[model samples]
Target chain A: MSGKVTNGAGEGTGGSAEGLDAAFFARWMRAAADAVDREADRLTELDSAIGDADHGGNMRRGFEAVRSELDEGVPATPGSVLMTAGRKLVSTVGGASGPLYGTLLRRTGKTLGDAEVVTGEELAGALSAGIDAVAQLGGATAGDKTMLDALRPAADALADSGGKDLRAARTAAEKGAEETTPLQARKGRASYLGERSIGHQDPGAASAALLMAALAEAGGDAEGSA
Target chain B: MADTSEGARVGIVLVSHSKQVADAVSSMAAALAGVPDAPVTGAGGLPDGGLGTSEEVITEAARRVDAGAGVALLADLGSAVLTVKTLLAEGDELPDPSRLLDAPLVEGAIGAVVTAAGGGDLAAVAAAAEEAYSYRKV
Candidate 1:
């Protein structure tokens, strides 16, 4: 994992899109689960300050469940693997974030339908759907101190940027995530924290960035194969 | 995904510390179900017992689950787990969903309902819910 963050549309340092299938997506999810597991305690610690301390633990459990479900024998299509994983998240997580994040994946997977191979543009649409769903549920806008702050911009940049490349999208997501530090939270438990929420970063937002970053790495591998 | 679409029914019983949590989870589950009339119901332990009165909380939660497809009980604390376990062995009002075990709530409930709605069986949904327990923040 590159601890260094990148910015703007030109930051396509990672690989581009290749054919993405079920196995590739499963691997992406696996990496994401691993990242979440590794940092679950950190996320929970962050949340412990402003939100429920369980956010990290909840996400870690949900993603781990997804990993188990996939390892047990996933479906044939890329979309199905994601759809199944999304469904699994919904069942295991028991907080506001669970449904919100789970819906993101489930909705995105649904957009892909049963496609065996997903294009860069299609993946963008799926991610957009996930972001939109989260926005609708949380009622949080782009500037709000919530995960949407990171997600909305990332989706927009990914959609409008140079060539719809995976690396470009990931860079956009990381930059968007960093931009959250200076703002006061207007939604979620952070919102209740008011002025105190300004200095601390939102854990959900951080994990959201992690998801995009890991996807970028995994997609790079796929690009190499293609 | 196991098929539970056919006469097979698996109910969702939301167990939160407050009615607000239960309502919110049920609402989310209904939305995920995508069917206007789909009944993804919930039960709350408002003024949550936490560690005390586990049996009472579990009984209520189990009753709610029993109302639907042979209830799947989900709770917030360890005692809630103990309470539900006792209810399974002693309560006679309805079929128990307690065996699904203690889960995260939001993700677990949603995953169970979504998978169940997508034709996965009660066993599969329960297993998915159990798997969801691992989705914890860490």
Candidate 2:
């Protein structure tokens, strides 16, 4: 494990014209589960510095549930796959991040409608909507030292490129996660630490970066199997 | 059987991560209200006894206490707050006029229960509960 979820594979970027389907979303979730499993210890260690130290475990359980869920006949549409995953995260994770991330995926999947497979343009819009929903749900923005710090930039990176360049999105997410190391806590439980939260990285952001890394891999933009 | 001077009272739902804490807080609030049967329900912990709140638990509790007036929802910390908020934002799962109170569990529950026991309306009950956010004990 690199202890960092970044653009580890730069060559196999999922092409711009890729049509994301249910299978693709299922694979993305599986990849996310695997990455989270690999990085759980590091995530817990970071959380211990300034958080409740359950981010890693909570995320592992949530994503592991997602993996098994998708394995059980992979929902009919891409939106359903994400919706299932989102529901699982909310029910099993039991924290701020779970609801936040759950709303993100649910809203995003909802915005995608019943499309069997969606073009990048539609996905871009849905992704942004999902991200916006998360922001509203958490009441935090890009600089709040939360997962949005990573998620917003990555979403922007993809949207700006017209939904191409998963590598760029992955890199942007990694960098955003890295940049949170020095920010004071402004949201979630970490915010309660006040000034003491400045040095530790945000576990939510780190997990979000792993999410993007998984997205890139499932999008066919990256290589290396989980 | 009811006096016209007594206004419509709202129901109160207390949500907490721990089942015991939720039940204790609700009971304490009811007792503090000096009302034997305040319309308050405690929706705490997952159905599986885990220390986390869930939408299902909250929804069921709200349904149990709802008397068609309204319901004031108070959640204690972290997932409890998130779970309640998520239900509120859904705008469909909870009762028609449910409001998620932004107040401490014990304090808010007492305030809300007292207000409801006194025949306060939904808005009044919610305001009273929220007022506990600034309630001074010093």
Candidate 3:
């Protein structure tokens, strides 16, 4: 889906779009943490139905750790910030989410390289890479009723929009997450429940949607400030 | 029996969802193998003693058990296996000659520890662990 940049080229002198700075990325992480915190109880409730009841707590704790690490000192580049956060999550968070989410951000950040800023198109491509890594690590697909349920659609929307319309990507993720309510989970702990896993929204997918919403909000805020 | 040399022996790592389970299994395996100082490490549960596996814990355990010989990892559950595999892929320390065995946790740990303590190389230890899967008690 990350073929080429199409619209909203930003205000760059060259043909490339304006690069999103490290501050924006940091805000994105902060927003995501806040979203996870807000939805932690609900996430846990959902997980308790078909899987382990630690999704909410795990995500909240991991994001809080990331926030604290960022507070200590924000990195110079967006990629570095994400890389550090990913590493922190990998080390601190337990369960499948730790490695899955950690791989996502680490792979995405690695794709961003050491650049101080990256264009929206570049960010979109990096996000796709990150989602792919998560899928590969977890051995999950779009219909697995895992985080990929939201992430795959969001990544596709972002890439289709050339990373210019964060709101559109957020909407896609929301829809994808909602759609997972009726699917029988095919991966992760929920798979053990068999047919009982159906009719309940996947906690990981729900959280992934929340993350996308936070990213959209951060993107809009950045635009407003600029 | 192999050479029983310090550097030639393989190391074993036991991964489980519960720290207590991992510790017990490691102890049982060591006892069964009759090797007091076998290079066996237990990586289970979260840092907070919760019921889950941690990549950091596994990486640390593997590092501690690796005594110039290679390391073999055996996990009890799906997530545990995934965590260990992820750590092996991403860890910076480079756990060379390390292998993740798809064997039953208790039996595999026992077989692996015995082989490793006997100074079996990486392949031999891994084979011993895998071989445990085929044993029939009946």
Please provide, for model 3 over B49-116, each residue's C-alpha lDDT reduced to its tens digit, 9 standing for 90 to 100: 88888877788888888776778999997678777777777756437868888799999999899988
Off by over 4 Å in 1: A1-18, A161-164, A221-226, B1-15, B18-138
> Each model's C-alpha lDDT?
0.65, 0.82, 0.82
Q: Order candidates by TM-score, high to low.
A: 3, 2, 1
Candidate 2, B1-138: lDDT as tens digits:
132234556889999988899999988999899989988989988788777777678889999888777888998887788877777777788888889887888998898999888888877787888898786889
lDDT (Cα) of model 1: 0.65
Judged by whole-model lDDT over C-alpha atoms, candidate 2 comes out at 0.82
- Which stretches in model 2 have alpha-carbon errors above 4 Å? A1-18, A222-226, B1-9
Score candidate 2 by TM-score against the native. 0.88
**TM-score for each model:** 0.61, 0.88, 0.90
lDDT of 2 at A192: 94
Task: For candidate 1, write residues A1-226 as lDDT tens digits.
Answer: 2212222223332222444567667867887898788889888987887776877877887899999998899688877877788666654655556556766787788888898866666777888987887676566788897788777766776677532555565666667767877888887667877888887778778888767766765655222121
Q: Residue B108 CA error for candidate 3 (Å)?
A: 1.7
How would the docking of model 1 be graded? incorrect
Model 1 residue B132 distance off true place after TM-score fit, in angstroms: 35
Local error of candidate 3 at residue B82 (angstroms): 2.3
Tens digit per residue, CA lDDT, model 2, A27-53: 788989999999999999999998878
Q: DockQ for model 3? A: 0.64
